[model samples]
Target: MSTVVQDRSSAGPLLAKTAIVTGAARRLGSHIALALARHGANVVIHYHRSASQAAQLARQMTQLGVRAWTIQADLADAAQVEALAARSIEASGGVDILINNASFWPEDTIWDMTAQTLQTCMDVHVMAPVILARALARQQREGHIINILDTRVTDYDHKHISYHLAKRTLHTITRILALELAPRVAINAVAPGLILPPDGYGTEYLARLASTNPMNRYGQPEDVVEAVLFLLRSRFITGQVIYVDGGFHMRHQLYV
Candidate 1:
């Protein structure tokens, strides 16, 4: 297990603001939502099928003395993506932050990857995020947008070809959108590596990968949260990809 750091400070850095975090029903998304709520931000926890989990998380966050609600949408659908933003804005009055964290990671080699799978990757990881960012821009003139990316974007993952392709496209999108939405909304990304084990894997899986990381450790969800907070709190930073991957990216071969 990665280091668990529970923030007990009463800072409330995001006081009176609203944040919409996609895939916030569990895992890293849940941690991100609670972190923001802990800082006094009302959170819109978005989920697709985890209805019960989403509601439970919303209730837990609300108990923290902040407003929290859950919204459901299949990110693979364009119309649903649009409705997600609209509903979130309506529920929270306005969205001050957007975190694109939902994704589908299926294990498949390049030879077995299908066009349909690739399209779903693009729809979920790239298209939906673009839609939400644009919608948030329309709703709030000034805010922060943080995309939860994979550290593999800096390297190759033949086993997850389609997933990697979509994430790499998102990596580029983050930079472009940051420039387009600059001076009003700062767009950035946090690339996590060896943080949590992939779905269907155990802690041992991450522990094995951790040994290969330069830091010789696995990262906690809170580490990613800290990077996000730094980006959101900054006034002059935008269009940057912060790797919370324990120096794994530095060791990856860059194709310059």
Candidate 2:
């Protein structure tokens, strides 16, 4: 058996495909949604509370000549997650792609980590993704599922205990589901590092730590977006994680 896979050229463009991108109102998720649309895939933007922004993004995507719909669903709620999947399927016939990018990163440490906080992290990062994957699998469609993870999973972030734990769990789930889903749905993850500032930070903040990575600069959302497109295009690759974090993931902070 040759280790080399079949030709990837046949995957072709994203036309005739519908992609559901969660938390797509803004941030990295928004960029991923736009890229999918630009590549000719109909897009379904999922936003928890950012209705206005989601609608605005939908308009932009439609301008790109791809069908775009904005759907509101609180991914932390299982019922809402189910509704999102159903709505996405209804909006575009069938879903050919699912991007589980909805997540919230709260600044918390061991001292500040409460049970509620931990559960909330898991709800959005773990449960919602799993639920969404279940729905995607049941559809019996040949598609791609990309879970947005963090490079910190390779190391650890003590300051953000719950987020770190949940994302790492998601990374494990990505690999496991890839095997279980098999030849039908290709599951993969893209772990991004310092691509965008966590909620309250500004560009200056990223610039301050720009040289910390081997790339010597901060990464843009487009970097992660392209990695996602690459994974979606590879017909035979699954259960893999692409680090869009420059070289940060390669060098783990053992001291931390």
Candidate 3:
């Protein structure tokens, strides 16, 4: 029931400030891009295969009165990840904010997991963020890097072993990079739970899960978006993972 008090004056032209959001063509990334634009930040939306969707998002951003561009890159490729960072800088003038939201989520039991599946998950969820962060650091630009982590990091689960391991690495980076980036740039994470479920999971499924939480409802994308904005504006905060889970983590079991 807490109201978000956005600083309208601090809304000073993010005019020239640019942000790169990977996997930004749809889902939560799209919401994050729109939220940043609402605060006046120019955005570079990165996509792997959702070309038309990325284009649509860019157009929507323009309508919000901010500059927006779309770039396509397969994050699984190291060279492509490097190029993604480079292109973001080139297209948007200079990357000021980097939201590492691209990830591979596969449903495979530990027994059924393959080496390729594990490696691919690691490449997208762990390595790409590292490469992108390294490239950004080399630019010597004061920036913010927000890695989107899953709420399950605090609690281990074996359902998606590869996905879980890769995301856990991001949590480690959140702390490590916070120290490495130091007084110049800020690095943090927003660990979301049930904001939007994976493909095939519907509202009824979400409601059932939400009923187990103390809040009794699934979180909305705005919840995480607000968390991101808070981290971005709070100069004193960094190296933290703010969970937008509505207390679901406190429950003993998530009744599927």
Candidate 4:
């Protein structure tokens, strides 16, 4: 990382800082990584299977005048998750921001929910975040941790029961970690709503779902990135969830 200090009085307030964003190869994670890099933070882009995409993203981020590294890790694997944090620390010299943006959005109804599938969801949404947070705490003090969450907590998703339950668990974990890592690290979350369509869905699906929000429109990835940036730049805020959803959480509609 370059030690030369530039006048960060500009929009890039996080100049010279380092951030780790999981599942950053594409989609919303990719947008978040680019936003952080645009704001002058060196990024560690974590991916599970998108090696080529991740490398391309790193190159683009570096082209923005910030350092970027790609790390592949299956969030479901505890060992790989741990190794990701370790490698990020070694590569960046130390981590100043940690964004738990990787998640598994499983589609299983209550009757269809199996032990194996439930365990996998829990491993990614709940267990992996806790492990990464603990590792980041050990690597650096006075940093920020942002968990990427969904707006379904206020509503219900019967079709994705296992995934919904795991995310709720992660929501609680965020608050608990905020208390546990207080004064050393500030932890918070950004709950996104209608930001991106699921794997099989199309733009029409998102357009139909947009009615659930009072805004009557879909949100862009930049909305979530702005929420993440707010949490990262503010030192006094912690354990809060900024819903980037277009008032959908307020309506309590089914997201799945």
Tens digit of lDDT per residue, candidate 2, span 1-256? 2211122235455776889999999988899998887777889999989999999998887767678899998877889989988888887889989999998888899998999989999999999999889888899979899999998898879999999999999999999999999989999999988888777889888899877677878998989988998998898899999988768886755223
Query: Which 10 residues in a row give candidate 2 its minimum summed lDDT?
Result: 1-10
Q: Is candidate 2 or candidate 4 better by lDDT?
A: 4
Which stretches of candidate 1 lie above 4 Å from their native place?
1-12, 253-256
- The parts of candidate 2 lying over 4 Å away from their true place are 1-11, 253-256
Worst 10 residues of 3 by lDDT: 1-10
Error of 2 at 136 (Å): 0.8
* Candidate 2 residue pairs in clash (backbone atoms < 3 Å): none
* Clashes by residue pair, model 4: none
lDDT score of model 4? 0.88
Over 1-256, each residue of candidate 3 has an lDDT whose tens digit, in order, gives 2122133356553445788899999999999988888787889899999999999988877776778889899988999988888888887777888899988888877899999988998899889998888878777878888999998887776889889988998899889999998777889999998899776777778887887567888988899998988887777778998989987666666544
- Clash number for each model: 0, 0, 0, 0
Ranking by lDDT: 1, 4, 2, 3
Pull out the clashing pairs in model 3: none
Q: What overall lDDT goes with each candidate model?
A: 0.88, 0.87, 0.84, 0.88
What stretches of model 3 exceed 4 Å from their correct place?
Answer: 1-10, 13-15, 252-256
Least accurate stretch of 10 residues (summed lDDT) in model 4?
Answer: 2-11
lDDT of 4 at 13: 51
12-111 in candidate 1: lDDT tens per residue? 4487788999999999999998888877788999999999999998888877778888889999999999999999888878999999999999777789
